[model samples]
Target: MRGSIRFGEFLIFLGALFLFWQYAPWDIFSALDRADLIIAGGIGLLICFLLALVSRWFALDELIHIVALVIGAGLISLSHDVIHTANWSWGDFSFIDCSGGPFSQERDDTYTHALSANAANPNIQVQVLNGRVDVETANRPDYEVRIHTCVRGWDFDHLKEVLDQTYPKPELREDGFSFIQAKPSRGFGMSANVEIILPQSASYKVSIDSSNGRLLLENLSATDLNLSTMNGSITLTHVAAQSVKLHSTNGSLKGQLSAASLAATTTNGGVHLELTPTASGRYDVRTTNGGIELDLATQAIGYAVAADNTNGRIRVNLPQFTTQGQSRNHLSGQTANFAAASIQVSLTVHTTNGSIEIRPQ
Candidate 1:
């Protein structure tokens, strides 16, 4: 977010210059007419620059010099053709058509390239420098080689070239999936993202470590799944696993563990787990510093269930499970008999400082 003081000062100076030019408008027919625009622009730039000096001299204390520098940079970006463009289309239209038609063609060009390449090889992974990755492996073949990537800048061709050079062999394996590594000189941030897709029937696994960026998993059917993030959120959709573990620090973790045993934990954060009634699976749910939710369905069977937390509430949802409590310890009682059942499932839930809710589906 741009600082308020810098924008305010720039707007004030621009307004003052606009009023001055209005009161004593420069004559267009004069010899200095063409030079007048340049002079006016220079004056505006100077004034904007002076705002920084004034702010510093006055020791505004709160507003620093960097803000003024940013304001000056904005002035340079707008000094040419901006006023004329604004004047020509000022009251007629409230919005500028700056959606990258003629002013920006690189965006369209690159997007087209990306679209084509992505369509051709959606399973390919792209790791951006200081940015997140986008993995599209779902419905694609399971990759054998693990890919770790680091990419920087907007040059996709250069990145692709570097990737080609780095992984010259493009190692082919029995499994169609190929792993590539792409890491950036800088790390993940707000603009960073990682997208991973896997074939619905493929037995595979994926783990992500990110900071302040999103991790998206779609249509992944794997035996084991692990996802972790710091100050970021994770969204997993249409994923079925045998065992899944998700953890975050100061970030929300949410997803469906349809056919797998689920465990999650967080510090100074909250967790939400959803098991659809249509979901027939065994779960071991746990958390710390957050609330826990369980969805009970007809297919849920309990051989042994455990929900424990130090400074958090524990709630379990079971239609056919018994409950027992003693002092500060909560115990379970069998509500239904399944002695002959072949499947033995369990739920282990724990927390340090949060609430737990186990409700019927």
Candidate 2:
């Protein structure tokens, strides 16, 4: 009986290690380097040790089990919090007072700011800890940015206070505008949705960095554009740029882009790209664990295409190119006019665990 119990404990220990390696955020090391989290961890460990010692002395197995249950519950809560706020700190250890799920409280607020677009084309940069971001052209030829904050939890006052303190106002600079969150709130769930309305007649540059949220860009013309997120989907429609780059860690990306050069990459989601015939530039898309769908204009002047998948099939629907190195997992081809190509577009798509589909629009 004792040997069986020991074996069960060993299996549990191995399972815990596997879960930590798979889901625990690697960025927690950065937090540990800080004094705050280190101090919090030290205090927590001391308390847990003392409680265990007391339970053992009193032979209170039930008490020990109760304490273990509480710790498990706390860890579950912390994991959910980490999904939204990737940064782990002492604040996250605070007990969340919400009765229901993480996002249960309800609160909403709107903020608006205007920018004076002179003769020079303006630039905009936004960073958010959580929530969706939408950028679109304004109906009028004016520059404005709007933010809608939504909070759902048991604590309303705490959420409001955090929102007001973290994001006071937009800081306007000479070349562009920026909105950054300084710190995260304790014991609450919230999200902020941002909308940037640019002048229809003017072209600008935009960059967005988000920790967790969907991003939507529509009907915007920019000289250079960059979009990145840790845990959210991305959608682009009617976007025109000279150079565009997009990245997501754990979400899908779908876009119809008109750009001189474009690159899109994701770790665990699919990618879909739709290009125009006149879109002549270098295009690259890659994902680790999801499929890829590429739609190219049938009347494209010239083309160079390559696609690969490690554990899935590959399909190409373009007739102009003669396929070589064709297999269930790899494809390489070029346009029929490869020798006399005039306006050429280079395309590359790769995925590790899913199919790759290329078709003409």
Candidate 3:
């Protein structure tokens, strides 16, 4: 989770490692000697560190996790079988963080702000560092956005200092407004939850990028909407957009979405989309470790589907769906009247280690 990892999480990791050491078979890892294990871990660490430094994908915060992992692996592998036989008291595990963390809601202070802009076609861009973004469509024709951010820290002084210094206010632009920002040093324990409200009468170009926060957009129409979160879920409800790109590295994507052109991918999560492809469009969705559930509007448009899954089952249910190729893990077909329909949709969905279910709405 990059910047989202905390000391308490490390405590949990140590606890798990202790449990595994006490119970798990040491012979499974006996295949590798101490020198071999050290060499292998060193090579992996070097490669990962170089990639992390060069790609900018992994931050310094992630380095803490990587180092912890290498240490844990080394420690477990080097430990002898006697460790499992050693008697350990329950008090040794008291360091586990059952309450999440030291920072609590009691130490948090809330702040409210509003940002409004006047534009026929507005562009609303929001970037969160370590919190959440929730955008909704409202009746306000003035293109207004209301923000509620919580500033938190270790104690009262830190909370007050951060709250006084930071407020999520939009910066006006020639096109519209941008709420993008870098994470503050004092924002370590903060929750920069930004709630955006878009006008129903106007179309927007919205872009939101969060490093470690959940994203939610509902009942919003956009000409172009881009959303990406590194470690949180992305949810869309009754969203209609001309172009939408959703990417989440560690979270699921589930909801009702109507996009003319869509490309959504998640590395470690599932995707369940109820799509209303009202017109000609191309949709692509991919996930690595999760299942995919796609429900299309049966009568609204014609669809040419190509869906695939590895280590999972595939099912396609549609009225008058012509099957070109059908197998346990692959399905390619089209609607009955592929050419006669006014609107046609081309969908490509793929997943690994999960099932694929495409059915008619």
The per-model lDDT (C-alpha) reads 0.45, 0.67, 0.68
TM-score of 1: 0.50
Q: Of 1 and 2, which scores higher on TM-score? A: 2
As for lDDT, the candidate ahead, 1 or 2, is 2
Give the C-alpha miss distance for residue 23 in model 1, angstroms.
50
The sequence of per-residue lDDT tens digits that candidate 1 reaches over residues 304-356 is 55666666555555666667553354545443643543444555666667666
Q: Which candidate leads the pack in TM-score?
A: 2
Task: Record all residue pairs in model 2 with backbone atoms less than 3 Å apart, i.e. clashing.
Answer: 105-152, 105-153
By summed lDDT, the worst window of 10 consecutive residues in model 3 runs over: 92-101
lDDT of 3 at 28: 30
After aligning candidate 3 to the native by TM-score, how far in Å is the CA of 161 from where it should be?
2.4
Candidate 1: where is the Cα deviation over 4 Å?
1-192, 276-282, 329-331
What's the TM-score of every candidate structure?
Answer: 0.50, 0.72, 0.67
Best by lDDT: 3
Tell me how candidate 2 scores on lDDT. 0.67
> Cα miss at 25, model 1 (Å)?
53
For model 3, what is the C-alpha lDDT against the true structure? Answer: 0.68
Which residue ranges in model 2 land beyond 4 Å of their true spot?
Answer: 1-71, 82-119, 150-160, 173-175, 185-190, 277-280
Q: Rank the candidates by lDDT, best first.
A: 3, 2, 1
Model 3 alpha-carbon miss at residue 73, Å: 14
